[model samples]
Target: MMITKEQRSLYRSEGYMILPGVIPPAMLAMLREECSYYLGYYDCIMDSRGVQTENISHRGKRYFINNRYRLSSRLWQFIFSDLMAEVARATVGDEAWLMHEQWVVKGAEQGMKFAWHQDSGYVKWYNPTTQHKPYVTCWCTLDEVSEENGTVYLLPHSRGGTKSEIITHIKEDGTNDLIGYTGSDPGDPVVVPAGSIVAFDSFVFHRSGPNLTGNMRRIYLPQYSEKPLTRPDGKPWAMATPFLKDGKNIYNHAEDSAENWGPFPEDKNVVV
Candidate 1:
């Protein structure tokens, strides 16, 4: 199994766990290639729009590219692989849905910092009435991360808040980031090698610092809900592509589309 029993216990108590260098070499290589392609793709799209900043993305500084899994030839391999399935069954549940996936990149020397907030804060902000259990954020790292290069810092349930509750968040003016916790806690910095996956609960308060090094810091994050998360109006909050049912992968690549997975949410502001 990818996750150990001790790690599972820690996740249950602390709301997060780190798997050190567990991703296979081949899979890691492919993810790096895909991330490079998507970074350029994001740049092209931003260039076409004639803007340096689009929502949370700054042209040469930082990016939060969300939900373009179908466009890649190999992303699905990692997203739906045995490694992810084990993670899903361990954290989310036996049944899981692909809630969101993104390439969060920090440009060399100028990557901006992300605010401290829970993943569920975005859900509560957009769809206030939708009640769902805490999901899992599999933060798959493509590069060795440190505090100097924008590594994520997680506030445990004990310090930040309860994992079962979603705290209200305020939208920051300039970066469009949602701030949930404004405490003095420095948070636990995650320093790990490439191919490590830091699995955290949706309600965990997490943030990252700016990249100071001359090399880019890249992270491919795939978030999974125990079940499909829907808005109060009955529309899906994000992609609900089936991944695990009864502890097994049920994703059919050929049949995957908007029609089958349900239409993606219309409001771009809801993209977190």
Candidate 2:
């Protein structure tokens, strides 16, 4: 799985590019089946009528994260595998590190909607110039996702996805409305086929619409950092996180596997 020059160019120019069939079908199928294992422990909030419910999600569509690393090691195997890391490194640079690995599940007919935002803002603990300036997040689809099923809607080839791009409420659960995107209109919906991989910069303005289709959209998200995991103030990271440091899985420490970990500093009140 080499990241072609064209792919690299597309990414740099558009801030994102979908690599069609980048993942082998067999691997994709296996991951799709295995995705259930990651979400098995958590239950979505439901109404008395047995219908899914959510405060922000209209009909209860939501994504769950496997923070405990309790699933089969195969998941980690595929994530940390050299083949995948190479793709990330192609864009983020040789020193690219896998900063995070998790499965994102959008259940069938669950109307899940992700607000428009950027990973840069979430990990603002790291200064822009000192830390990894530009990062890439690879989103591998385990299921065929289309506009009908709420594929991602994003703005491409722009200096978007930053705090400045968002002009609406800037709270923990802020709508994160883009500079010009009104409630009635967002961006364009992207159709992602199964086994496809979408790599986008952390600053790309992107969000997915509500899934109204009758199938789940399961995506494996692997975040890549171009440099050593360190905060703006010279504090180390990932060493205390559950990420793959330099392509090696380090899940042996208690603090490394702790839950409820966030990116903001202790004194910051940006969000939980």
TM-score against truth, every candidate: 0.95, 0.71
Give all candidates' CA lDDT scores: 0.87, 0.59
lDDT of 1 by residue, 84-125 (tens): 999999998899999889888999999999999888888888
Writing each residue's lDDT as its tens digit, candidate 2 over 1-272 gives 77778878878787777788778777777787677765553443234446443322233356545333433546655665665766766667655555655666667886566766555544542343433465777888877878777678766744343423322324334332222333444666778678888887766667777678787777887677766557666775442233344544444433432244454222210110
Q: In model 1, which residue pairs have backbone atoms overlapping below 3 Å?
A: none
* Candidate 1, residue 93: lDDT: 86
Model 2 lDDT, residue 237, Cα: 44
Off by over 4 Å in 1: 257-272
lDDT of 2 at 102: 62
Sequence-dependent TM-score of model 2: 0.71
Q: Which regions of candidate 2 are displaced past 4 Å?
A: 44-60, 125-132, 159-169, 172-185, 231-272
